[model samples]
Target: MPRRSEAKSGAGSAVRFFVYRSPMKKPNTSPAKATGRCALEWIRPEIRALRAYHVPEGQDLVKLDAMENPYPWPEGLVEKWLDTLRESAINRYPEPSPEALKGLLRKTMRIPDGMGVLLGNGSDELIQLIAMSMQGSRRDKPRVILAPEPTFVMYRLIAMACGLEFVGAPLRAADFSLDGGTVLDAIEKHQPAVVFLAYPNNPTGNLFDTELLLAILAQAPGLVVIDEAYTPFAQTSRMEWLRDWPNLIILRTLSKLGFAGLRLGFAVGHPEWMEEMNKLRLPYNINTLTQASLSLALDHFSVFEEQITRIRQDREKLFRALSAREGVTAWPSRANFILFRPAGKSADAIHAGLREQGVLIKNLHGNHPLLENCLRVTVGTPEENQAFLEALGIVGVK
Candidate 1:
């Protein structure tokens, strides 16, 4: 009964409704989808399940966990460093061998004669290079690395990254001292290929017995890495002993010597061993700017010496202050930081209280078996140290 125009209009309306029901879209099959599928199937097993290391955030607060030097270079010396950088050829790649920096380091650091120098972005990179060189070359033997627990974590982490087995021996709980007898026993059992000993241990801030360290060096079947990152504060070194022990590699850094921003660290060891390690080193690990700046800083070593002296003095003051406090057990420290256990109060609560007061220190509770209820405070300037002591009083025994 409808006219032809009305019927045609009804058909057009039906077609519009069908089009609206199914909205159009581009194809869902994309390059990103294919790439994601490939990644899930082809990623290495070790990396897929890996957990990254946790470094504390909050640098605006008192940063004591990383053990960085709190002082900056004096203004005049900094000006001199700037002048040197102005002349640097930054557009050109840094020297492959970093000869000028090495020469200055050798003279300034008083590196032992005949020992070769190997530079790293930080000591962390050097550790990786050592592990890779050892593992890559010696595939037949079961590659083993040993480190005393409560020492540096990087040694074990690096070894694991290289797919080498890591053995961790425990320190004596009575004083956190090295148990030479136990270490020797472990060496015999495992016949480890690399051993790491942090001279002034972190989170504890106490130096191990040197006599025992020497004893371990004598018996170990493979390379021994002595991490002396805090050597500037301690002022005692075994660099002279490099002449006698070819297996020894002494690691030092400017991080604690007022140049942490530069991230410069080096290893001194027998030339033959370092030669092999150097072959595996990346060509331009040290940047041009860093090399230039470090060379200038080394030329003015007296500034660094003065700053280190102040830190050492401050450390003693902090130690005495911590010892005099009621119920706190502070251990003797040769490094620029002190480690103590809070008495009658929970370390976690004390750490939180300090955080609220805008003063942050390390809380070592449950980090290791021996470090329970312990906290580490880096020796800041006199004013900072006083402020920290005052903050402790506010949070007392609560």
Candidate 2:
């Protein structure tokens, strides 16, 4: 692609010049003349076969689908945060490896000594980093990425996007629990380069067994990433395990802690792994505004801590309420949300009714066999929870 511009040396005279030009090669526009010719033919077959992950529009609804904390900073803290941001230098680039932010994260996240931290815009980017780094030198035996089915979808998506094989071991359908024997068998068979386990697994709202995790960790031949995105709600962490397991990495994010807008996530692991992942990170991925905002927010961590406590309490209340409903079976949750299956009604129709009543939530009716009729709702404030419950009642969901 090239651009043509005109420059006038004098008042009347006009001159034409190629002011701008693209240095890289442009896409091939020639017609293939095949049985069915198209631009998609240029794309890799694996990429062309992928379906994008979709997020529904939550423009005017109560917006309880994304598992976001539905709270804002206190009045006094908001003013202080604005003041802190006023001091940030937008004209200058941020430090490539933000030492100060890393220090705060280490202290705030309780990372153990000798462990290293690498930041990402979010856990999604960190997953991309890990996938990219695992593209082994040998192509004969392509690298494999493994995880339990019905967990976080990104683990498999990223692997496929990176042209690596993905193997998903199915979780027990009875209660969505990890089957140790099956997972171990898959591990032995696949020899994956990376394995992801989402603690307090999403859409299921229960943690995997600690003993099973340890057994898998010991038997695995490669890195095991324990995604703790909801650690704030769970009130427990595996940060200390980095010192014990060289192949383990703990991935966390502040999105669930009321900072989803800032999109900050960190990976704590052995320096050897961190150093390599750091190499794949783009320069200054953490912007000035995010760094400034996070620093200010950490100064008032107690506010967020209080909010987490309230959410946990609200979660218990919501769980009890849902369980008491005539035809709803709610699963126990340690995270800030609950997953339930509708006993007699269609999950899809109920989800639509909630939307029509100005409440939005995730409907997992057909996502997986284990989640046949499941719906997840984030624990919101007391009023929001009441509104959701009332909407449920209005829909005649006994």
Candidate 3:
């Protein structure tokens, strides 16, 4: 007994329902309209042109690409660490200022009294913090970040992220070493707001000349950040230079000290610079668990020291083994890793062949002009090192 209009409307409802029920049906559309949108549309254009940092996947394999310590903490020490963490109040927020961790770090690191320590999730975060603090109020001047190529990629990545200009000077080709004159020239030309020099440069695995570093630090117009992530292996640090150059900041981490899982890195510098960086740092940036675990681990430094010593010894053995082999040129390294070039054969072939054999190492063939046909290997346990050496023998450079 429905009226004709009601019947028509019911039919329309049924049609709509049918359309909804049909998975293949497309929505009806009106003419495309350019409506109100964010004024920051240009941000997308900028981002699209930027290359993101690619972290390698090596968790399942031998897991050596990241230069992490290949050993775990002593079982007893680990248990004690866990017991210490048992009382942590994870339900509540951690202290905004991790004073205890800082104190422990100062004591453990033997940090100078006037210097301040800033903790980072990793040294990467500290790099970002340095960039943020230096960039400050100037979007127009185009803050400059100066670093040598074939070094840490984060310096350039972070600079690009902050919309700052990055100037990468190539390392000396013969040895992949820092060229002080060239670096000083770049500093003079660019007037960079920040300069980063990775002590014991990555991928090349050689420490920069100390005298040259001091000269560059003296000449640099802006802050000089010396990333000493591999200091444990080298057993040398510029920490004492804090008083000599207020513009100097030294970065260190537990990653190479057998606690990559904890993700603890610290930057040591004058308190004034640290104060500015602290202001921009997120409250409770480091979680309670990490701080507690790192504190416990620091208390037992001998355990970590023994592991590092073993790695250094293993590194020497690996270097000697590679050097004796034909068709591969091994570079000297102060780090727990080695960088070598395949003399007659393509590094790619060796890398792929090793991977096929269940061995993994970084193939740095085309990354840079200096790194052509280069492969970097982390120093592993005696057994692991022997395995890698045997794999190399099978692949045999040429």
Question: For each candidate, what is the lDDT?
Answer: 0.84, 0.90, 0.84
User: Which one wins by TM-score: 1 or 2?
Assistant: 2
- Flag the better candidate by lDDT, 2 or 3: 2
lDDT, residue 130, model 3: 92
TM-score for each predicted model, relative to the true structure: 0.87, 0.90, 0.87
Residue range with the least summed lDDT across 10 consecutive positions in model 3: 14-23
lDDT of candidate 2 over 196-259, digit per residue (tens): 9999798788889999999989989999999999988888787788888999999999999999
lDDT of 2 at 396: 85
Candidate 2 positional error at 95, Å? 1.9
Candidate number with the higher TM-score (2 or 3)? 2
Compare the candidates by lDDT and give the number of the best one.
2
Stretches of candidate 1 exceeding 4 Å from the true structure: 1-50, 136-142
Prediction 1 global C-alpha lDDT:
0.84
Candidate 3 per-residue C-alpha lDDT over 1-398 given as tens digits, one digit per residue, 9 for 90 to 100:
22222223644653222222334666545334222233235455555586787666765666556687888878899789889899999998987888888898899888988898998988889999999887743345778999998888788888888878889999999888888888889988888899898888887888888898988888888899999999888888889999889999999988888888889889999999899998888878888899889888888888888898999998999899989888778999999899988777788999988877678898887777878888899999988888888888788652
The number of residue pairs in model 3 that clash at the backbone is 0
